[model samples]
Target: MAIEIYGIKNCDTMKKARAWLDAAGIEYRLHDYKVEGADPDRLKQWAGVVGWEKLLNRAGTTFRKLPEDDRAVADADGAIALMVAHPSLIKRPVVEYDGGVLVGFSGDKWDEMLR
Candidate 1:
């Protein structure tokens, strides 16, 4: 299966995810948003699969630091706009496998889905 992992390179959770992938011997291409910048089209595709609620990292420092008005994202378009403006608002380690997409890091869930 072709897998692509997206996130900031230095993010702790991202590091764990990368380690887990390596331990599992899963070969994947990294799309580090810190350098590559998150693609709006890909973000929308992921949102379509997982929903914007799951894709948006509201608990992250970047989202929390946003002004009250900016944080009031109410729909997919709004959330997408916010995420495009601030890639850090995206949940870390979004994985796109051939069949589907996975958001966030859950070792058990990834093992179940990818293996």
Candidate 2:
């Protein structure tokens, strides 16, 4: 399967996900949002798959630092806009594998999908 992993390079979760892929010998492409920027269209697509609540990283500093007005707007469109402006506001280690997409990394989930 062809996998495309997206996240900031230095994130601990991203590091773990990359390491897991490497150990499993999974060939995947890395798309660093810090460098490439997160695409709104892609974010919308991911939201369709995982829902806006799952795609947005409200616990992250990027989201927490947003102004009250911006933070209050938490719908799909609002969240997508925030993510487009601050890619770090999105969850870490979003991986696209073939026709399926996985947001966030859990060792068990990775093992099941990769195995």
The candidate that wins on TM-score is 1
lDDT of 2 by residue, 8-104 (tens): 9999999999999999989999999989999999999999998988988989888888899999975899989988999998899899987688999
lDDT of 1 by residue, 18-64 (tens): 99999999999999887898788888888888999999998988988
Question: Which portions of model 1 miss their true places by more than 4 Å?
Answer: none
TM-score of 1: 0.97
Worst 10 residues of 2 by lDDT: 106-115
Estimate the overall C-alpha local distance difference test score of candidate 2: 0.91
In the predicted model 2, the residue pairs found to clash are none
Name the lDDT value of residue 84 in candidate 2. Answer: 94
User: Which one wins on lDDT?
Assistant: 1
Evaluate all candidate structures by whole-model CA lDDT and list the values in order. Answer: 0.92, 0.91
Q: State candidate 2's TM-score.
A: 0.96
